[model samples]
Target chain A: MNREHDREIVRYRAPTRINHWIVAISFVLAALSGLALFHPALFPLASLFGGGPWTRILHPFIGVVMVVAFVLLAARMWRDNRIDARDRAWLRNVGDVIHNREENLPEVGRFNGGQKLLFWVLVTCVLVLLLSGLVIWRAYFSQWFPIGAIRLSAVAHALFGLILVCSIIVHIYAAIWVKGSLRAMTEGKVSYGWAWRHHRAWFREVVSARRRAD
Target chain B: MALQSLDIVRRSATTTPAPQARGAHSGQVAKLIDVTKCIGCKACQVACMEWNDLRDEVGHCSGHFDNPPDLGGQSWTIMKFAEHEHADGSLEWLIRKDGCMHCADPGCLKACPSPGAIVQYANGIVDFHEENCIGCGYCVTGCPFDVPRISKHDRKAYKCTLCSDRVAVGQEPACVKTCPTGAIVFGSKEDMHEHAAERIEDLKSRGYANAGLYDPAGVGGTHVMYVLHHADQPELYSGLPKNPVISPFVSLWKGAAKPLGLLAIAATAFAGFLHYIGIGPNRTDEHDEREAEREAQRLRAEEHP
Candidate 1:
């Protein structure tokens, strides 16, 4: 109990956890409605959102909510997610990390290299999706653009949406793969042992702060 | 639609083939417009409005012979009037009937995301089932000739159907029936082509050397075609693209992108499942706690020393 890593430690604040869940919930909704409009085979999914018309009506608005929520979440965590030379070294040992050979890897900080990469990829995908979404948003903005541009934007929107969906799947899988990680977002805390094993540098920073407080 | 017109060969946003045990016995129908003989009277336009039971308000004119200005929810068809000057300084009024072409490969149907919203009959008339239309306006982008306007009232797409309703009843479209100059003709597509050939010959004899047919094959040819006196200059009449095809982007969007994008998403999810099976969960065990305590001790000693 004398060791800081032997006890519980706060990983996320309540506001951040709430914001993350908002982004997650909104993203699932937007993706479902978007996929409904993406292909005819998935058209049946539109019924989940009240039908095709409602899916079309609510998809962009849902996307906006997710984007707005993610912006806040990303802003709150971006400094910790910044990749450095140490992150590159951790990336080189990704196979070992996957095999549970944490001893062979460099000390991970707040986020691993994979997490940082996914974060940046998500940022790019969201930016593209929002812009292209505006260009093809039929009820409103599409009328302002030319047919050629609208057609192109529709294609771009689908492409980036696929990337976003895939990235999120990986994001969720990563959270599940690392035990005790889900609690960080769900309960706003993590076992200090889990933090020290996965994010040793960050665990040390937290301990140094605790020392300063004392 | 009438029961007789139930032979939908292709439906929008549908992957499976349509039921085609019969139908298509009448061959494909077509409407031919001879631009040289069009007097810009707009009688066909009025007839379309009367037959369709739509009345676009008499909007203010923009100093052109074209009135009710452009096609809209109520106006399915319109006469586009263009003033032209020949190289020899001869003025000719080029009048064109502008509406849906009823493309053999309808782009609106191809791009539509709502099942049964847009359909193509076996006889080649592309029709919109407004009841099923979600009105995302994808058809407007899908069109090669830029037809298919959405109604502000109900947010459903509207365009000329080549008057499939009248054709099903064995009658000509109201526009074709009302043309005063014998300029607008309707028949089987083959007969219309033969008629256009004879008209082209007559125009060539009268010194319009460029007179030809405007049945562009880029969209697999359209059910509605034009016999333009200056066929070489189709753009002179309006912004008619010389060679219109479904935009490459639309093809990519609704075509390969669909199955491939879905596949990529599924593969990502499946990969996660496989990873779970391969590595199991990375749990923080008692050994991990001991390791963390050792590291904390090392950190404390480094700080104190």
Candidate 2:
């Protein structure tokens, strides 16, 4: 534990931490249900929840919960997700990210351009899924609406789902691409060297803290 | 009588002023196709190929009007046949015109890494610009309708622009113009919504209880809406999934993992800045030296005082 103190420790607030886990758990449930519905070959995946009947019953409910939880998450992070001049520059030189040339890129603050863009994209996708899902919901809205409206909603929902999945794949690959990144979410801290190598500006703040303490 | 005629002319002029009309004319108008009214005529397909100067012999078949099976670089849209058994045990053939949905929150737009390639027009039509496209196939993977087709020649993506050129000139799409049945409706989104509602009510009165309008708030609500005959199981005819979801794993990757990774990078960079300024974790000896020097300076100042 003392060794952990010797290392840099950047902690997320309790709310932020809890919100992340909520999203993580909900996402896993949603992905399994979605896979079962997307193709018959993946129908066996329904067994993860129980069987086809249970999967069908649980899918929409889980989706609703995900949308609600994500909306709350979006509300809290909206300010940080906004694009700024630095973010624009970062996007312009996004090649630096793929090449692992972080030293050449501009010093990023809290969230980088990639992170901000992902946040907004996810938020937009969730909103679309929620609305489209509700419109085409057979048990719920089909009784009140017309067939034409329901068909259109189904198309919109499917399109958004595909886009959201692709964007998320990129998001995952980027996380694994960068070293010491998974630790921030898992252990809630990064090493002193990891901090210095990646976030020089923030590393200075921590060093200043030690100086003030001394 | 002359005063009344002059008042009528003034009312007409005010109501249909050129500036307001021009403002309304400046965007692409989408068409919602009603499958029940279609007769499987391939006139629109031929017109699209001719207008786009696409080759005709690409997906030609023998003794069949269905030229192409699906949308491709050359084929923007096609009419698909859905055969089903009615409650009375008779066979019913439903022909649907399949094309781009032009979703409000288009997946192609989100997945497109290239700027100015896949964009949503002001009128909610998702338009493609080939010049900026990287041919990444991301849009192809992301589109739920499988609308975008990569050109074998140039390797860029192409899809229905909702006839953006024709719509700009206040004309309906070729498919709508050639429809033998009044199945395809082209107009403003609001007008179509009202028309779709009335059509659904008419169908409901005829005992099509499952009939409902399809744009249900998904992907921010699609510009195109559909009126289906089999409202209970429209997916059987529409090629649409009953329950669609944006996989939650995607949310975790975008919302949690990626941002946390970036934060870790920022933290490491901040540590490096400290090291460069000689106050980093690696400079404990230097920090002690600085402290001793500061104490000596304090003693000298005290002695002088």
Candidate 3:
């Protein structure tokens, strides 16, 4: 509990961690069910969720849940995820960052350039998916639009869905590849070394704030 | 291949070959509608409703004789009426029966993601098997003719089947059988094309020079072909798409896009896996931890000592 002895600092609060996991779980469900419906080769996956009908019925609902959870998470994390001049400098040294030469990079804040870029990409893909989903959603809004509009929306939905799934794959891989990152989400804390080495500017700000509080 | 079930030649979303035994005995059937002979009496529509047992809500007139206004889940077929004036200023009432074309390269079957939801029989009848339908309504988007309608009650797609059930028993479609003037004819595609040629000759003899058959090859020709008087201006008959083909959007979404999307997703995962193998985890060891604690201690000491 004591940061001085534990050598750990709070990286995510309990609410933030819970929100993130909800989004993650929903994304997995939605993606799998969607892919199952998207192609015939993956049709066997429909058995995992009752059958084809159930998978079709559940995917959109799961997507809606994910969108709501992601929106909440994004609202809370937007300030920290914003890209700045220092983040661009960090990106410029991405080769070093990828090779673990963190010392060569600028002082990154709460998020590095790669993470910030992915955040915006996720935002864009999610918004497109939502709009296109409404248009092709046969149960409700599709009849209101013309066939041409529906066809375009169907294509857009598939393309954006592909982008989102790919982006999330990278997101998941980065979280796992960075040794302390999973613990930050799961345990709501990261080691002082993690903060200092990866996000020194944000660490300094946190320390100053702690000093002021004391 | 039995008489009751028309053997399926193609299936939607199917990877393997379809049943092939029913080919030698019967040629592809077609229903030809002679628009010039159609009196717009809607007798065929009435026969369709009775045979299909469809009672679409008796919709009020919408300023035109075309009852029900447009096709719906219940209404499988409707007669579209268009009043046109020749350059000579004489009015001609063009009546066309609007229903499924049952394209040889059916877009509904191609865009369908569910196996056996839409099927094309050897007799060239593109049919909707509602039991297999998941109600995704992809067929509605894929239909070049905009014929399929998803029902609100059961959420299954409904369209004219070209009377596959009747054809199986060696009978013409109810509408064709009931046509008072023989405006609708059901027979082998070859016979119908020959009949349409005779009709076109007769129409030309009557000074209707532009008469031709509307068997659009863009959709590989349709099972339900039309003999239009103004074949040059087929669009004159209720916006009959001048040159209808499956929407390119549907084609890309169902065609190259599928494999490309799968490849992109797989490539992303592969890249991440390769990165991990090449670079390993970016970890902070005990030395880094000690250095970080020492710096924090120095900072606190400077502030509060």
Candidate 4:
């Protein structure tokens, strides 16, 4: 690679990238296994997880893995994702952002308004899922809850799971919609141009910090 | 289950209609339990274990005649004895033959996630296909009557099947056949209703004015009807829910939520696909690179100069 292309900046550190992938991988497994139980049409997906009983056994454990991994990643990103006045303006101009006319929008940062919204949504959903999951977990905690609570938790679990899945669909779609975004999580770096175009404020900060260090 | 292959009216977690014609044509049956006549002899409980070949471990009593305290995998049926004090202060032992009510609308089947794990026979007997059971215990949560017991051994749910094995071959349930006091009777649903009416009339004539048949319409009328002397309070007979309906939450979760949630998910993905085709990807081209390099150089010059 030429020196020009070598000017790529760090978007996510190695630890953050690894933790994000752990959450991603576990989320996929948990969602698929959960969908297997959610509807009979999706029942065949159980075979991918060693059939129904095994799917039942593994889904909650996968969810726990996802939750723990996500908690770590979220803690790392929480400061960077705090919403501010610029983020609100950026959110208001989401139409332009989606259409690739982001020049007039507020200077985007390390995490955009949309990304912050998704982050909070994920945190809320993961918390709900963990609580409701315990109540409906048949092998253990279910007996502690009364039938009414069990019923409520079972319904809540499914509903939140749907919301989480939908939110993740949007998250995955956003990652693909923006070019070079995937590499931020995959290789832990983003091209200088990609960072400048997508997150100009963060790009300027990183450049000044690099100059200061030098 | 052996005879139900050709006549399943409903199958749990199955969206497609079951083999319906034969099951609909078959006459639904019922077991009438006269709670007024039950001596709490526990013959029915022993009959259940013997017929199903389930021998629960010999456990100590919890200071009551009810052995094992409550139903277990090996014990599909049990007599629940409740002492009720009348308005006149006379104590009455309300002995209810507690087991699966086998509702016309079976909640267990509705809540089950496994295909064909729980099936309703044309004759209204709901039987569990343990082989298909995933052992998540959703049925226990779904059951308004709280009848299903999940086996610790196999993790499969077990409950009173109303002797579906015997019913398939034109024989009555073992419990119905072995009640020495003639407290339990099995027949066509219509015949059972008629029999219940006669018993109710007899009790009313004997001054039990609140006597009535407990068919419980909230669950579309259970196949297991009870002739209760104090039917005004089914709860008095060991916490029978006053009106058992499939929980609104369970109904919502398994019903509209399924299709609506799927639609939302599909729409989201499709929306993304359409955007990809329409707006295309937002790229960071040479202009962005030039801008970044110039800004970096300006910042460096400002710092050094």
The best candidate in terms of lDDT: 4
Instruction: Please write out the lDDT profile of model 4 over residues B32-121, one tens digit for every residue.
Output: 999999999999998998899999989997887778689889999888889889899999899998999999999999999999999998
Return the clash pairs for model 4, or none.
none
Question: Candidate 3 on B126-202: residue-level lDDT in tens?
Answer: 99998889888999999999889988888889999787788877999999999999999999999999999999999
- Give the docking tier of candidate 2: incorrect
Give lDDT tens digits, candidate 4, residues A70-134. 89988887988898999999899989988999787888878899999898999999999999998
- Model 3, residue B234: distance off in Å is 1.6
Task: Summarize candidate 1's per-residue lDDT along A27-105 as a digit string, tens digits.
Answer: 9999999999998989999999999888888999999999999999999879878889998988888899778888899
* Winner by DockQ between candidate 4 and candidate 3: 4
Ranking by TM-score: 4, 1, 3, 2
Scored by DockQ, the top model is 4
Q: Candidate 1 residues B1-305, lDDT tens each?
A: 33544588999999997765658787789999998898989899989988999988779979998887788889999988888898999898888999999989888999999999999988889999998998799999899988889888888899997888899889999999999999999999999999999999999999999999999899999999999988988998877778889999999999999999999999999998998998788899998777777776777777777
TM-score of 1: 0.96
| lDDT over C-alpha atoms for residue B78 of model 3 | 96
Query: Candidate 1 vs candidate 2: which has greater DockQ?
Result: 1
RMSD values, in order shown:
2.3, 19.6, 2.3, 1.9
**Per-residue error (Å), model 2, residue A15:** 50
Where is the poorest 10-residue window by lDDT in model 2 chain B?
B5-14
> Which stretches of candidate 2 lie above 4 Å from their native place?
A1-214, B1-28, B60-66, B86-88, B243-264, B275-305
Looking at candidate 2, what is the lDDT of residue B170? 68
- Isolated chain A TM-score, each model: 0.93, 0.86, 0.94, 0.95
Q: Give the C-alpha miss distance for residue A92 in model 4, angstroms.
A: 1.7
* DockQ of prediction 3: 0.71
Task: For each candidate, report its DockQ versus the true two-chain complex.
Answer: 0.72, 0.02, 0.71, 0.82
TM-score of chain A of 4: 0.95
